[model samples]
Target chain A: MEFCATWTCPGPDGPIHEHAAAFDRGRERRVLIVPALFEEQNRTRRLLVETMRRLDAAGLDSFLPDLPGCNESPQDFAHQSLHAWRRAMADATAQFAATQVLAVRGGALVFPAHLPGHVLEPVKGASLLRHLLRARVISGREAGEQLTIEGLLDQGREHGLILAGYRFNPAMIAGLEGALPAHEGQRTILLSELGGGAALWTRAEPGEDAAQAAALARIVAA
Target chain B: MSALASDDTDDRLRAILRDVLGLNADTVASFDADTALFGAIPELDSMAVAGLLTEIEDRFGIVIDDDDIDGEVLETYGNLLAFTAARLG
Candidate 1:
């Protein structure tokens, strides 16, 4: 329903509890939703949550957990990396006893690959990084500051750079540059398959499509 | 590289615009070569341009150089389509 539940993940120092939105009715089919990363997370939360609602209506239970540094979590976003997120998700899977996963957008990069489920519009970590860098470049241009993707990436790798208001550490930058979504044992669901005009993640603001959500739930529930 | 049809590029570009800008089907279908983008559409702000470029690259399977992009390239629907068609060719 809401953040009425918490899942324990191994933190850098010790085990940490993170807020999770769950639709649990003790259904036989439980889906762990790995939401889109970064700004895309905000852009697609409603769509994912709507989809979860439909899944629940279809007699499926689902859990949408926050990444350690995201949402209501007390962790610092800058200190997070792909490795840490993957571990956190893996722990989420175990703790929730999720039978299937629903990795959306960049979440594909960190979803537990060992489980069979669905990946919606999976994107490479490099692409995600490029999108962020390009946004920074565009904003820089508008502000009369010349910034190149290559230059920003170099700086990010050496130290850390704030892209689109997100402070990323060197490890996070490096990890994102090479992270690719795992495909084995997962069904790739493209936007086309969902019969949607465009993915919510691409929009400048967050929006939702009820038809798209229903289509996704039907696919997952089927 | 094999060339892509001009009509195909036009359709794909329109689709990208519709998806990226969240334009309705009628609005996208009504887009002509002279249809202004960027400043004309409020949704096509600087942030959206980033996503638009990345989606164009992904759909068209061509890498876009940052130096090659400018206001001129995104001035109109025609200009963007022509540029993508040129890259495909």
Candidate 2:
């Protein structure tokens, strides 16, 4: 049972629109899924979609809410901040009355502290930023441009620079660089893969891993 | 672990390559101890390297320092298995 859902978040400027793919059973044990950051989010989208489908089969409802300025939201990425994204997640949890959360990759960075949930492949913001910067450099070189991490950050500081196809504002860059996920949460599960599979996010194209998605659903359902 | 045990470990590592690196099962199935990773596989670039390390750390319950990462550790299937086994031991 899938449906499109929307939640309104009170942003500093005005109301922010948040969108989601909901797997609803109207059951008591609903889980909110917070996906990975930026490029990772797009890469892991299929998995999240599949996970939601499987979760419905497993008799548990879940919501895959898009962070503000991402996915189908009307908000602009140029102004999106780590704190706003975090608040949006919390808002989704409350709007859905979700009891648990399942965070993927850098999603843990924005996961609410009070909600009990599972974390899959938790990553620090600094590490994520470093990888993004590396990819930006590679792409820049491939495009015959001499782009450096320092230079990119400097540009971002002045105005939002599009890096790896995502706009990173000065505030967003600074917040993401320094932001760390709070460990004092109701975190109950930690899931990571053990075998050889490509990191889909780094791929030039989007890819899917049914096996990985199935494994995650099974863990969350348990 | 005996030679046979080491062989088993190698097989498992290959599966990890297939799962975490998102390599095709058939492609990874042909990989042996001599199969070059890291620089050899196009998917195993800098970003994938970080993902691979995180996957390895989580799966094996071992911590890998950023400084410890060099070209040698991920050179081949055997090298990765040996590195993991050493940390496990």
Candidate 3:
């Protein structure tokens, strides 16, 4: 079952309340799930939720927290930064008392180092930005916007640019472009189709792969 | 015909193709140098290309500079394998 919870963290404006969903097993072993960013998050949310259920079944508690300006959070995306998100993840870890982390894609950029966990498909910020730019360019062309990704990126640097319905500030873009996946723990899981059906995040719409969730649950439990 | 890679490099490239493209084992097993990749396979889109490059770099311990990416490098299964094998050398 999904239990909604919130974590308050200091932000540039004031206190930001970040929402999280806790998959409760009433047990002590807990895992915090840091999700992929932007559209990727929407695409993989179902798999993450399913994995949380599997974790609950395996007698493990899991928490999926939304960073500022994401999910149910009302914070402005324009004000969000990698630094603030890193802090948010840390706060969630302490608030939920999580002992392990399960991060996917760009989430690895902000993963807490002290906790032992699995990181799947860890990506660099520059690589992520490139992909995001490609997507925006393609969509822009389809919409007849006559916008180039280079132009958009330059505009973002000058002020902010809205990509795929999400507004990105210059600071956030710079922070994300410089961020790289960080994990000191030995347990790292690369992308595979063994437990997952495919890379659902590449799909155009929200997708789910139960096998992927099962694979993730098994790894985290192990 | 082009130069052939060692059985090991060929095997690893095949596995990488299967894993990154999410292809079935049978499909990957039958694939050869002549097999078209980027444009032929619908799943090998721009986004999938990023995932493929990241996976290749991770599994093969290679660093694919942005300049290394081009139409010729990703043209076929053979082209990708040779690029990777050359990197390994």
Candidate 4:
């Protein structure tokens, strides 16, 4: 569990160094893991880390990088756009010399399309945005304020509204509205394929499933 | 919808609830039409409802309008299953 500087993002100040959770021993098969975005990232982090450990035991090296606005990065979450994240991922892929890629959920939207790998449960950006908007609406109802998804989206498009606690800029919201996971050279692994009860990304809270982790690792290893 | 199709929707809805709420297989299997959902189940919070609706749309290949959503729709297990079946039609 080494925290190593994996890539650099061009910042207003200067080049910003970004770190990653790396399980590297200079193995032959190196994989760059592009994680799910926002709140889903939190729910699936433990599962991804567990999978990384399994991959390590199987003699494979993996690196899960912190995107510009995520994790330990110094960048503002509201300032991050999908385009910037894509560039950051491309930088990580090159810096790590990743031989393959493993994109999880919304991660597929930004993963380097040239690299051949696997995409687990690839989701459309529209769906991701809808989830966030719906959550905000539900929360508003609880607070005795009426809110609608369309109404919130309209607001988000102009001034950028906070959804599910994440500050999303107009560019980020617009980018997400049209983002879709690339599937050309990647194998799409569905939840049914993993034989899981339900995906951790959809869970109400952060949870771990060793069986699910092992299933994913096995697919990646094989 | 045919009887077979309705049964399929019922099964899928159950599976979605189990997966989204992190409910056990047996617990979900035992859920009947009368079982309360949104209020009764601790795991099925408002946030979970968002994920649940998304999953339902994805799995059933149905687009659910926000106007169609209401407390009554999600009040019981049977209501959700029936709503999903109607969408699939």
Candidate closer to the true structure by TM-score (higher is better), 1 or 2? 1
Q: Estimate each model's TM-score.
A: 0.89, 0.72, 0.71, 0.88
Kindly state the fnat score of candidate 2.
Answer: 0.15
- Tens digits of lDDT, candidate 4, A1-222: 464646787876888888899998998999899999998888999999999999999999999998888888888998899999999899899988999999999999999888888999988999899899997887677677789989999999999999877899999999999998886878988877766446899988889988888899999988
lDDT pick, better of 1 and 4: 1
Candidate 2 residue runs with Cα over 4 Å from true position: A11-13, A188-199, A202-204, B1-89
Q: Cα miss at B3, model 3 (Å)? A: 23
Q: List candidate 4 stretches off by more than 4 Å.
A: A1-6, B1-9, B29-34, B85-89
Error of 1 at B32 (Å): 5.6
TM-scores (chain A) of the candidates: 0.97, 0.90, 0.92, 0.96
| Docking level for model 4 | medium
Decreasing lDDT order of the candidates? 1, 4, 3, 2
lDDT of 4 at B63: 91
TM-score of chain B of 2: 0.82
Tens digits of per-residue lDDT, candidate 4, B4-88, equal: 2467777878788878888888999998877898889998777898999988987888898876788878898878887888788
Model 2: per-residue Cα lDDT at residue A104: 79
Could you give candidate 2's per-residue lDDT for residues B4-70 as a string of tens digits? Answer: 2366666666667776566778998887667798668887765566666666676678887554555
Rank list by TM-score: 1, 4, 2, 3
Best by lDDT: 1
- True interface contacts reproduced, per candidate: 0.59, 0.15, 0.04, 0.63
Model 1 C-alpha lDDT per residue in residues A1-222, reported as the tens digit of each score: 553579898777888889988998777888999999998999999998999889988999999999989988878898899999999999999988999999998899999999999999899999899989998887787678888999999999999999878899999999999999986889999898887457899987788999899999999999
Flag the better candidate by lDDT, 3 or 4: 4
